[model samples]
Target chain A: MTAEDTAAPARRGRPGYDRQQVLEVAVRLFNEQGYDATSVSDLAGELGVTKSALYHHFDSKSAILEVALDDALSGLESALDDAVRSHSDASAQLRALVRGAVGVLTARQSRVTLLLRVRGNSDVEQSALRRRREFDQRVAAIVRAAQAEGMIRADIDAAVATRLIFGMINSLVEWYRPGGPVDPDELADDVLRATFDGLQA
Target chain B: MTAEDTAAPARRGRPGYDRQQVLEVAVRLFNEQGYDATSVSDLAGELGVTKSALYHHFDSKSAILEVALDDALSGLESALDDAVRSHSDASAQLRALVRGAVGVLTARQSRVTLLLRVRGNSDVEQSALRRRREFDQRVAAIVRAAQAEGMIRADIDAAVATRLIFGMINSLVEWYRPGGPVDPDELADDVLRATFDGLQA
Candidate 1:
C-alpha cells in the first residue's frame, strides 16, 4: 500500500491519527518491546490514545504486524521481480536485486526491522517467514543461474552466497540512518562492489 | 570463561544444574522471550526449579543476563585479541578476525544471538552494548589499517565496510545451526571468500 493509503483520512475512526501513523507507531513499539509483550493497551498508551481509539484504526496487534511484515516482504518481492524483468543476464539481475533490496530497506527501515525480528510466534509471523523463505529461494536461484553462466563465482554454494550477500545488505537495518552521510544509492553501490568484486586491493 | 567454569558444580546450590546449564537456559529464554519480559521465576519454571533454587545460582534475572551477555561478548573480545596477536599484517588480521568471529558465533550461537538482540533496555544491556560498540570500533580500525596498507579495497569507508562484513558474519546467528549442513570452518571460508575475494568466477 502507498503512503497515501495510510495517510488517507480515517473514514470511520478518530480524526487525529491516520492508518499510516498508527502502523508506524505500532511497528516501532513492536520493535522496541517484543511483539508478544506489546499489548493493545501498550500501543494505545504509547500513542496517547484510548484502547478503543487505537482499535478504531486496526482490529488487533496481529493485523498491524501482518501489514508491517507485508510492507517489507512486498518490497523485497517487487525488488526481485524488477531485477528479473529488467536484466537480461543473471549477473545483472543479481546486482539490481541487491540495489532494489537496499532501496526498500532504507525507505522502510522500521517495518523491515520488525520483519526481521519476527520469530514465527504467530500465524502472521509464520506466513511472513514463509514468504521470506520463498524470496530467499528466488535469490538463490538467480545466484545459481549466474554461477552456471560463469558470471558469478561457482565455488560457493548458491544458497550460501545468497545468504551472505543479503546478510550484508540486510545489515543496513542495524546501522544505516536515513538522512545520514551515506545515501541509499551509495550504500547499494558499496554493497555491490564489496560482493561483486573482492575487497583485495 | 571456559565451558568448565560453567559446567562446574554449584557449591551452594542444589544438584543437577550447573552455572553453565543455568546460563544456557537463561540465554535461550532471553533469546526466545525478550530479556526484559523474562523473569527469574520464568527461568526457574523453565528449568523446573524453584525461584529460590534459581536464585541460589543467579541472584537475579539481571545477573543471568550479565553472564549470558558476557559469554557472548567475552568470546568476541577474545576472538579480536587472538586475531590481533596472531597476525602482524592488517589484511591477515582482518581475515583472522572474520574467521575468529565465525568461530565464536558458531561455537556459542545462542549466546551470540542473544547478544545481537540486546537493545540496551537496562543497565546490564547498556553495558553489553558498550562492549559491543568497542568491539565494532576495533574491527573498523583493522579495516582502516588494511585499507591504508593497500591490502583491501579503499573505495568504501572502513567503518561502513566493517559493518557490512560483520553484518554478514553476524547473520550466521539467524540461520547457522550446529551440526547443520554448513560447518563452522566452511562457513568462515565462504564468508572470507565472498568478502575478501569477491564472488566473481
Candidate 2:
C-alpha cells in the first residue's frame, strides 16, 4: 500500500491521527506479513511517523491487536444477532447468518483473517481465541435450535458443524480476490446453498 | 510425539546422530511452535542433545528446513499419483482425490500442516510455494477432465474450483482431531460428498 493509503500524517493539517486509523494500518500489515513477522516499527514507518508516534497512539502491539479484535468481535456479534432475529425459521435464520457473516468477512477481510489465524501465542491472541470460542458457542446454539426444528441433521455435533461452517467461511479470504469472476454475494450464496442443501439433485 | 516415532538416524553405533535425525526433530518442533518461533538451540533442546551435537548433524536451521520440506514434497507427489489412479470415472476420481488427500493429512498431520503454513520468509519457502503451485496445476487438470465429462461446473474457472476443493479438504488438518467426535474416513466421505453434490438437497 502507498503512504497515501496509510493517510498522510498531515493531510490538510488534520489532527494528530485517529486511533482507529492506526489500527487499520496495523491490521493490514499483520495480515500481509502475519502477526509474528510484522513489527511495530514497520507499522509506524507505513503511517509516515516514528516508532514513538505509534507508541503514543497505542501502548503496545498487543494493545492495538486488542482494540482491532474487540471491534471485529462486537461487529460480528451484533450482525449475527440481527440476522438471526430477521427470520423465524431455521432455514431462513441459517441463511441470514451466512450472508451476514459473508458481509463481515468481505468488508473486513484483513481483520477477520487475522482472527481466524490466531495461534494463542500471547495474551492478546488468547483473548481473541476466547471471543472466537464465544462466537462459535452462539452459532452452536442456533444450530441446535435448527436441528430441533429438523432443519439440520440431529446426528451431527453442533460444535463440529459450527467449526466447519466457520472454516469454509474464513477460507474466503485466502481465495476470493476482489475482481474475481464471482462477486462476494454470489460466492456467499454458493457456499450457503452448498452447506444448507445437499447436491443430490 | 514419542522418541520412538522419530525417524532413526543412519549409520548408528555411536549415538545414532546424523543430519536426517536432527531434521526430524527440528521439523516436529517447527510444526509445534511455528517456523518463526523456533530456533536452533530450541531444536537441540527438543532433540535431547547439545547445540554442538545438533550442529554436527546440520549446518544450520535453514538446512534442516530445506531437507524436511523436500521429504514432504516427495510424499505429496506419490499421493497425487495415487489420487489419479484411485478411480476411473469423473465423480469417483474426484472423491478419491479428496479421500486420499485426507489420508495424507491424517497420516502426516504435523509435517503436512507445517508445509501448508509456510510464510515465504526464505528461499526454501519460495521453493515450497513453487512446488505447491505445481500441485495445484495437477488438481486443475483433474477438474478440467471432470468438466469435460459434464460432471463439474463449466462456468467457474477450473483452477478456482480446484482451490476451493482443496480449501475444504485441507481444513481437515486444522480441526480434524482423531478419536474425537468423528472418524477420518467418515469426515473425508462427508467432505467429498459435500464438495461434488451441492449441500442443498
Candidate 3:
C-alpha cells in the first residue's frame, strides 16, 4: 500500500467534497456564527474549496440551509412517525416520542442548533418555520389524544402542554453536547420521567 | 382636561424618547430580525428618530442589547430572590420561580426573545451569557437541595434536571403570544403542574 492508496479513498466522492460533509461543516459554521453572519466565502474557505467548487454542489447558501434544516427535521418527523406506529397507548407513545427526540437531538446536535436558531427571515426559513409549526401541531394532537384517554391531565391545554414538553426536549440543542458527563439515554429517561411522572417525590 | 393636555403627557420624557420605551422597541425589532441583522439605522428609522437622538440614550447598538438583556435578567433574578425569600421549602420555591419566569416571559416576551437569542458576539452579549449561566447554576442548586430533601427524584443529576425544567419554561419565548387563547397566569399554573405533578393521569 502506497501513500496514494492510503489517502485516495478519503476523497473518492466528489473531489475534496462530500455533500453530507459539506452540510455538516455548514451547519457547524452556522451554529457558531449567526447564519446571516456566515457567508458563502466563509463556508468555502472552511471547507478548503474554491467558491466555484462549493457552488457546483449547492446552488446557494439558502439551499445549504434548506438541506441542513431538513436533515434535523427529517429525523424528528421519522421518530414521531415510528412512535405513533409502534405504540397504542397515548402515554407510551408520548414517552417514545420524547425518547426519539432526545436520540435525534443528541446525534444531530449541530444541525438541530441551526434548525432551532432559524428566525424565518427568508423564503427558505419561512418554509422551515411552517414545517416546524406543523410538527408542533401534530405533537399537540398526541397530547390531546392522551388527555382524552385519561392518561394525562386534561386541565392543561393540549397545545400548551405539547410546547412545554417539547420545549424541555428541544432545549437540548442549547446545552447538550454529544460527549458529556450525562449519557443521552439517561437524559431521555429523565425527561420522560419528568414529563409523565412529575418531579415530585 | 383638554385633548392637548392628554397628548402632551404621552411624550413626557426626553422631549421625544423614553429610555425604557426605546429599549422595548429595540428589543421588538431585534426579536423580529436578529440582533446582528438589525442595525442602529434601522432602529432609528423604526423609532422615528434621528441617529443622534437614538444615540443619546444608547451609546451603541451593543449598548441597546445590553440594556435589553439586563431588563429580562433583572426581572428573573428578582423573581428568584422573592421566591427564595418567600418560600421555606425547595419545592414551593421552585414552583414560585417557574411562575415568576412565566410572568416575566409573558409580560416581556419580546425582551426575553432577544435575551434568548444573544450568541455572545460582543462584550455586552458575553456579560449577558455569563449572567444567564449563573442563573442556571443557582437554579440547579435549588434542584439539588430539593432532591436532597427527597421532594424530587434523586436519580437525575441536579444540573441536568434544572436544564430540563427550565428548558420547558424558557421555550415559551418561541411559541407563546401574550393575547392568545391561554392566559399568562393559567399558563404559569399549567407549567407548575407539569413540573411537579407531570402529564400522567
DockQ of each: 0.80, 0.39, 0.77
How big an interface RMSD has model 2? 3.2
DockQ, Cα level, model 3: 0.77
Clashes (N, CA, C under 3 Å) per candidate = 1, 7, 0
In model 2, the runs with Cα more than 4 Å from the true position are: A1-17, A198-201, B1-21, B153-157, B198-201
C-alpha lDDT (0 to 100) for residue B201 of candidate 1:
85
Give the range where candidate 1 chain B is weakest over 10 consecutive residues by summed lDDT.
B1-10
Candidate 1, B1-201: lDDT as tens digits: 332336666454544676888898888888887888888878877876678777778778888888888989999999999989999999999999999999999999998998898889889999999999999999999999999999999999999999999999999899998999998999999999999999988
Candidate 2 docking classification: acceptable
What does candidate 1's lDDT look like per residue over A1-201, in tens digits?
A: 223455566455544676788899898888888889899999888888788877777788899999999999999999999999999999999999999999999999999999999889889989999999999999999999999999999889999999999899888999999999998999999999999997888
Which number leads on lDDT? 1
* Candidate models: Cα lDDT each: 0.89, 0.74, 0.86
Q: List the residue pairs that clash in candidate 1.
A: B6-B20
- Residue-level lDDT of model 3, residues A19-116, one tens digit each, is 67778888888888778889999999998878787787688999999998998899999999999999998877888999999999999888888889
For model 2, fnat equals: 0.26
Q: Taking the tens digit of each residue's C-alpha lDDT, what string does model 2 give over A1-201? A: 335545445555433557878988899888767778689878887787678878888899999888878777777887788877798876577778888887788777777777877888899889889988888888889888887887776655677667667767777777677776768887776677556653222
Candidate 3: TM-score of chain A is 0.91
Model 1 bad stretches (over 4 Å): A1-15, B1-15
Provide TM-scores for the models. 0.94, 0.85, 0.92
